[model samples]
Target chain A: MKIHNFNAGPSVLPKEVVKKSAQSIINFNGSGLSLLEISHRSIDFLEIIEKATFLIKRIMNLNDDYAILFLQGGATLQFSMVPYNLMNQEASYLDTGFWAHNAIKEAKKFGKVKVLFSGKNKNYTYISTNYHIPCDMDYFHCTSNNTIVGTQMKIFPRTSIPIVCDMSSDIFSRKLDFCQFGLIYASAQKNVSSAGMTIVIVKKNILGTIRKNIPSYMDYKIHIQNNSILNTPNVFSIYTSMLTLKWIENQGGLSFLEKNNQKKAKLLYDEIDQNNLFENKIHQENRSNMNVTFFLKEKNLEKEFNKMWKKENIVGLDGHRYLGGYRASIYNALPLESVQFLIEIMKEFERKFS
Target chain B: MKIHNFNAGPSVLPKEVVKKSAQSIINFNGSGLSLLEISHRSIDFLEIIEKATFLIKRIMNLNDDYAILFLQGGATLQFSMVPYNLMNQEASYLDTGFWAHNAIKEAKKFGKVKVLFSGKNKNYTYISTNYHIPCDMDYFHCTSNNTIVGTQMKIFPRTSIPIVCDMSSDIFSRKLDFCQFGLIYASAQKNVSSAGMTIVIVKKNILGTIRKNIPSYMDYKIHIQNNSILNTPNVFSIYTSMLTLKWIENQGGLSFLEKNNQKKAKLLYDEIDQNNLFENKIHQENRSNMNVTFFLKEKNLEKEFNKMWKKENIVGLDGHRYLGGYRASIYNALPLESVQFLIEIMKEFERKFS
Candidate 1:
């Protein structure tokens, strides 16, 4: 039976990409050598990284002003790197979820990080409406979508300050004005590729502005100068991302993926709101299409609900450790049928108990 | 036709490791899910990482005083991280090769870096045998094997200060007194895994000595606390390393592999010394078993030699761009038959041209 995978990060990937990646691992381009064994400087791999960088830029409609780099370490590394390279004296960040809070924490180490707004008061059930961005700050940082709590920032704050967004969870799944941000980074595990590499798209002008001497690996300017080959990169992850980004391009780019994601999210969320046994706690407008958080109305029936999903082969539905409900992450690779199957389980539980 | 592969670092892996790794990528232990899709926090990955850490410590005969960690950004990142975490007022470094010079360069940014010795006068053809490591320095750093010019430090200096070794190119290829070092790091691409992940073995007591505020990712103490999962690690690279390490264990551990490596090195080095067309420039005692760098005695025969190797379906024969000739990297995974094949080509070229 096909497992209805909902696990966030290192999560579902396109089947075609997985198959092709496996084939490459065994015999890369019929070279009689596994991709794992080839040199990154080899023409085969050089073409891969080049195409990966090219695909992402074209897929996102990014212009020549941007530099696309695939670097090791996840988005967490970028938390420190962003501030190390760009933060001069002060920066602004929104505390939306667990990861966003971490970005704020790491940034504070380099300089002052002003929390523009936080959703912590209501158990992170909504995104803040009113916020102020100090223009004097070096940059404004925000999480585009909160994976842990299933909240997203739909309307970005309009300001002259360079907006640095952490789009780890919802990048490439929706259409947005990417030009509005100075820097954007996403851990490939979420929606891009595997779990080893992070993709960064940065405006060239925003780099090298900090006075502090940045470590070479964390310095964006150095990486851009080296064309992202400053060191040995995560070859598998970058190749996987290239395959995935090509898949997106084939499916008509972000606009089509965004529409498919919406369809899946609506099917799951509608069942959560209408079913008597379930409750969708996150505010309707701020709810994330990438991750849908729902809970059992009656706490005592948790065991029954769990049994139903297990029998239906639903996986990764358990919420984050910090949040103990259920979260169905409907990422770009998750098919609509999986969401439909999950709704069937939710409906059956409602009928049996309600 | 079987290719006699000899590319250094990201060169070749055990065939079994590549096969199993590729299978896991597709189905992942019959879980009906690709390994690329499973969460890093899942039980499967957690077990893989734990076993990997255990195997390395046992293989190296490390006591509880050592901490094993798998990190990203390769050994180049370690160039900066070592100084960031351990350097106090000053440290000593030996400049042996292209990479060693880079390590010294990065360390200078953190504190005063004293050059204990250098091989620059000989075109990095030999390791400096005499070096005074001051006890006052926080640590003495050296490269165990220089991949660029095929020089290996057969003997290390005795010192009271912490000894840090960058064993990137020749880790686990020979038996050594691993307990003598304060820290040992190897980028997995060379002798361990695919790429992106670097293996770090550090003595526990040496940490927390630097009073500087280290970045979380760069700090060894933080990675130790997190059990090498400080962030989403290079899952593919880690998994591949685990398989290769397991292969090493099944082949009777490092002692057996060390003897086999010596046999292969002796066979090839003897042929190089006897062959009239080729030259081995590195000092005899400093010649590396892992990477054998050779040059054409008669420069005009370079075209014939290149043609001969290409005809045999051999790849990755070119040496580092800085040193133009050939570098045959005979890692543990490379069969002795490949060496024999390469020797056959050299003998044929000499018979034809000389």
Candidate 2:
């Protein structure tokens, strides 16, 4: 039975990508060596990373000004690395949700950090778009999507200072203007690849401006110079990412993915709004297309709602630990039929209850 | 046609480990989700990491004083992290080979570094155990095995100060007393599993003494607090490592592996000694049982030697780019039969030449 997986991260991968990844584990491109066993510097792996870099840049519509890197340490590492490399004295951050809060905390450890705007006061249901950017700061940072609250920034705040974004949850899900951001990083669990690797797209000229002598592993300039092969990378994750990218390209790139994602979100959100039993706290314009969070109106119906979903073969619909509600994360790999299936279950439960 | 793999790191894995890992990639223990597609916080992955942590400590004969962590960003990350978290004023390092040199370079960026001993002047043909370690230094660091030069420390140099070892290449190839080192870190590609994940074993008390506000990702204390679940780790690598660890245990643990590894090393070393066509560089006492590096007596036979090995379905024998020769890394999973096959080919080639 194919479970309709809606995991937020390390989440659903395309069936074809999973099949090919499994095959590569046994034998990578018929090299008589498992992809897991080969040297990262081998011709096969070098080509794999090269193609992955190309695909990421092409998908993002980025140019030579940006250097594409596949790194380990995930986005959590980037929390500190961003400040360690970019912040000279002070930086401004938009505190959106859980991950963005972490980015702010880590930045403060290195130097002065100014929280220009915060959604915490309102439970992070809405995006803070009308934020005042401090021109004196080295860079402005924000989380593109709040995974826990299912709120996303549809329009980025323009700032004279270099802009940084932690697009961990919604990086390749939509058309992103590459020119606006100085640095963009995303952990490859949600929409890109698997867990453990982070894709960093940075404008090359933005690095080396900080006077602090940064550690090589965390330094963007060093990684760019080495082409992200500073050490033996997470080869499996990068290769898996390559397969995912290939899958996305085959599905007709960002435009098609964006449309599909929006359609899925509309179907689920519309059901939640019309049905009295369910409630979506997020504002309609701010609701994430990738992660759609909802709760039961009566609160007592939570258990029965969960059982119904389980019976329908739904997985990862349980909300985050901090938030006790249901969240359906419909990433690029999630098919429209799965969303439709979830909608049908919701409507059936509503009808039965009424 | 399974080629005999001998790559130094990211090398051969046990047949069972590979099979089980491939299966998990498709469906993790019948969870209806690929291992690559599950959240790190999921119970399934949590259990996998717990088992892996337990097995590593148990295999090493470590007590609760030690903390075992599975992290992303390979041993290369450890180069800077060690100094950032451990070194306060000054540190000492043994100059062994390529990786050790890199470690020293990274450490200097944080504090004063002193080279306690250097094997470089002699082309790393011997391990230096006679050198004096400075007790006043913050910590003394060394590489347990020189992968490129095929030299292993038969006995570690005792130091009163904290002792850290980069055991990337020869971690589980033999049995050893684990009490001597304050910290032991190894990239999984060598003996543990695949690339992209690093295993760190540290004495819990050694942390918080430095007083530096270490980055969360680099801080051993933080990782220990989080049980190495501080961020999204390389899930695929850790799971695969757990499978390999189980395979190691089923093969009768480290004692059996030590005996098997020694026997394989002796078989090949004896051939190199007896056969006048090839010459081994390192002294007998310092010779590594994990990686056996050698060269042709005439150097002109290199092309023919490579071709002969290729015809026999032998792989990863090519030396490091910096060093031009051959390195056969017979990690724990490599069978005695493979070593015997390699010896047979060496003899046949010798006979043909004679």
Candidate 3:
């Protein structure tokens, strides 16, 4: 059975990346050693990390001032690390959904945190654009994409305070002006690599101002100065990410990904609107191209809809625990053909019920 | 060439484990989804994590009182997490080697750390057993095996003050009384899985006593309550570890491993003793069965020795950067034939030079 994977974060990966990574696990670069067993300090691994770092800088159009780090723990760790390293007195945060709220929660432990905007009252179905960016804030934080609610920030708010964005789901899936943000972090499972690594791109000049004695692993200055090899890193995750980036680069980088992403989102969103049986919860303007969420208009049809998708070998189409319905996370690796197939199923589902 | 891998941590994995892991990466258990692409929340992954947890307890003879957590960020993060979670005001640490020194350095940020003994003066050739355990201290920390200097603690000191040990290098290689320690942590790269994962075994009752607000990801109590699914874990690393543990369980568990480990260590140590070309660095009683450190009697023979080993397809025989000597890390995965092959090469080099 051809499985259509759509689980949010730790989601689908490029087929080529999967194949190459598997081969490397058996024998890494013909070195007669499993990728799972090779030293991170070896020449082969050093090249892999260097290439992965270089590709991120090149694809994102980031300059030399930015340092690319492949660290362990997901975006959750970054929630504390961002505040621990950057926030000395106060920080501003935009709470869009679950992950953003968690980030805000972590930041509160470090120093004072001011919430600029929150979409929680609206069930996170929309993005908030009308909010004041506090000038006195140490940094402004926001999640670029809300995975659970299926809302995405279409345009980043212009702020004088150094901007820190958690682009976990949307990174490398769109074109953006990289210079505007001082620090950007993304967990690898979404559009990048496997589930264990987090990629941090930080502007070097913004660090070291804080007086707190940061833990060595969480310290950005130490990781940057040591070239991300301060300790034995998650080598498999980093190497898998390198293969994923190679795929992204080959497919014309973010520009190509953005176009395909738009096409996929439109195919599914247009069907949801046309069909009477289904309705998207998120506002059209704020709809995420990565995670397209919708629910059946008739609640009783949920069981039948789930059975139909499962029969078709579709995985991870169910919604999150907090929000019940359906969330089809169409990451960069998910093909347009799969999206079209899903649309066909949706239309058939509506025809039988309506 | 069939390469003889002897790299320290992120070292050799059992052939069966590597093969199975690679297959899983392609299509996990006929699910038509790559292990890399499967959601961590899926039933497939949850079962894997549960089984891995269960086996660790069963093999280590740990009860429900101990919390087994498979976390990300290697042992480097544990150096801080150990103190951040357990230490209230003061802790005692044994300065065994490079990693031990690093642990002490990270502990200083959390509390007043007292060094009971340091092996630095003796080039970390021996573990200190002469120190008294401070009654007032919160915990006593030590490294069971030093990879760099090739020393292993023959017997752990009987300490009442919550004993904390970093068993990264020699974990699961032999049978030991697992109940003697309050907390035990090991980096997965050594005798476990890949580099990005860490295994933490802590006593459940000891936590929540510290009033300090530990960052959620670093807090053991929260992680335990959440069943180590606090965030998106390194799925690949965890899965790989499970496969390795399965292999260990299949091979008659730790008792079988202990005999094989001793045999490999004795074979290499015998060669080093008999051959005048090479000399073992550590004291005879303190030598690590996991990592055997040695030096060439004549420094000029280093280049020839390197060439000879390279020709035989031996990898990771080079010493750590800080110390210039050879370190043969024969982990559980390495077959006895590979060590014998290395010994053959060592004898040949001596014959050619002598």
Candidate 4:
């Protein structure tokens, strides 16, 4: 049976990407050496990173003002990096869920972080647009999508201050105006690429304002100056990301992916509302298109329902440890058929048990 | 011609490791999901990491006092993290080569750094072991191997302070007591795995001493507590490292590889010493077994020598830009035949030119 992968981040990637990356590992571009063996500064890898950064800007419609950096340490490192590079006086943050709060926790170590709003009052069930952005703050920080609670910001707060976003979960799966944010960082384990690399797209002017001796690894300016080759980078990760970006571009960019994602989300969320056996707790409008989280109405059905999905060859359908519900992360590469297949299983479970 | 890869690193991995890792990228352990697509928290990956860590301790014979952490951001990140976590007031460092100097530079930012001795007076051609490490310092930092100038420290200075060594190039290629150092960090692209992952084997007690709110990513204690899954790690790189380590064990562990490495080094260095057209400036005792550096007696022969090697399908023979000549990085995976193959090409070139 073919496995239907609904894993969260480091989740499903394109089949073609899988095949191509696999081939490269054995003999990279007919170089007679494995991709694991070539120098990062080689002409082959230099072109790969260069093309990968070029594709990121082209797909996102980002201008030259934005410096694209392929960094390591995941988005967790960015929680500290964002404040270290931008927060001189203080920064304002909107705590959406676990990761956003994690970012806030790290930002506190660097300087003052005023949480403009938090979703904790309601079990983080909805994305609040009610928070007012303080104009005097250094930067307005927020997570574009919260994977844990399945809440996504439908609209970002308008502010004169530069907007910094951690879009680790739902970056390439949606469309947004490119100029609305000053900084954006996403872990490659999501819809972007394999694990081990982080993409940091920042407007060049917003950096160098903070009065701190930021370490070279944390400094945005240093990475930009070095073209992300300040040190030995994750060459294989960057190459894998390049293949993924090429796949995304070939499928007609964000406009096409946005439509594909919306269709998938609609199919899964509709099944949740119609099926009495399963219930979704997240607010309807704030529901994430990338991840659909729903729980079985009768908690005792957990074993049977899990067995049903496993027997049907579905994997990674379990929700995050933070929330005790089922989550199907329909990323950019997750086929619409996977969602349809999952719905069929949900219906089958209802037919037998309900 | 079959290429003989001599790239410093992201250098050659074992052929078996390359093939197996490539297969995993397509269908990880017959799970029908690409290794790149699986969650780091999944049972398969957790087992992979657990086994990888277990094998590391077994191969090195390190006791429970050491915590083996699979991290990202390479050795450069460790430059900052080592000081951020261990250097309470000050640290003493031996300035040996480019990367060693980089560690000292980053350490100076975190705490007072005293460079006990620098090889820059003689152009980093030798490793100096005569430097006095201050016992008052929190740690004494040094690099076990220098890939840039091709020098290796055959003996580590005995110090009362914690010894933190950056063994990026020659780790796992030789056997050592391992208990002599408080911390040892190595980039996986060298004698370990692919790029994007760093192996940090640190003593458990030496950490938690620095009086600072260390960032989660930088804190060794946090990583140990979380079992190196503190955040989303480079799952692919870790898996590849596991494969490489397993390959090492199957090759009769470090003792066998040490003999193999010495044989390769002996063959190449003997050829370099005997060749009338070539010369090596490094102190004989400090020469690296991992990377052997040699220069042409006639600088005008550069083009002809480059042509000869390229024609023979020898890649990455070019030396570091900092100190230009030639470098043959005979890492653990590089076969004795490849080194012999390089010697044949060198003799062929000499027959035509010398």
Please say which candidate is ahead in lDDT: 2 or 4: 4
TM-score of each model, in listed order: 0.98, 0.98, 0.99, 0.99
lDDT of 1 by residue, B232-350 (tens): 88887888889999999999999999999989998999999999988899999999999999999888888888987988889888988889999999999999999998999888888
CA lDDT scores, all candidates in order: 0.90, 0.89, 0.92, 0.91
- Candidate 1's C-alpha runs over 4 A off are none
Clashing residue pairs, backbone N/CA/C < 3 A, model 1: none
Error of 1 at B56 (Å): 0.5
Question: What is the per-residue lDDT of model 2 for residues B1-354, given as tens digits with 9 covering 90 to 100?
Answer: 768988887888988888789898898888888988888888898999999989998888999999999988888899999998899999999998888988999999999999988888889888777888878999999999988888888898777898999999988878899988999999999898888899999998888888777777888888989988888888988999999888889988899999999999998999999998999989899999999998999888878888898999888999888888889999998888889889988998898874
lDDT per residue, candidate 4, A145-201, as tens digits? 898888899898889999999999998888899789999999999898899999999
Docking class of 2: medium
Candidate 3 C-alpha lDDT tens digits along B160-216: 788899999999999999999999999999899988889999988778889998899
Q: Write the per-residue lDDT of candidate 4 for residues B299-345, one digit (tens) a residue.
A: 99999999889888899999998888999999999999999999998
Per-residue CA lDDT of model 2 for A1-354, tens digit only, reads: 778999988899999999898899888898878888898888888999999999988888889999999999988899999999888899999988988998898888899998988889898888767778879999999898988889999998788888999999998899878789999999999998878899999998888888887878988898998988888998888999999999889999999999989999999999999997999999878999999999998988877888899987888998888898999999999989999999999999999774
Per-candidate DockQ vs. reference: 0.77, 0.78, 0.85, 0.84
Ranking by DockQ: 3, 4, 2, 1
Candidate 4: misplaced stretches above 4 Å?
A: none
**Retained native contacts per candidate, as fractions?**
0.73, 0.72, 0.82, 0.83
TM-score of chain B of each: 0.99, 0.98, 0.99, 0.99
> Lowest lDDT 10-mer window, candidate 3 chain A?
A1-10
Can you write out model 3's per-residue Cα lDDT over A184-261, one digit (the tens) per residue? Answer: 999999999998899999999989889998999999999988888898899998998999999999999999999999
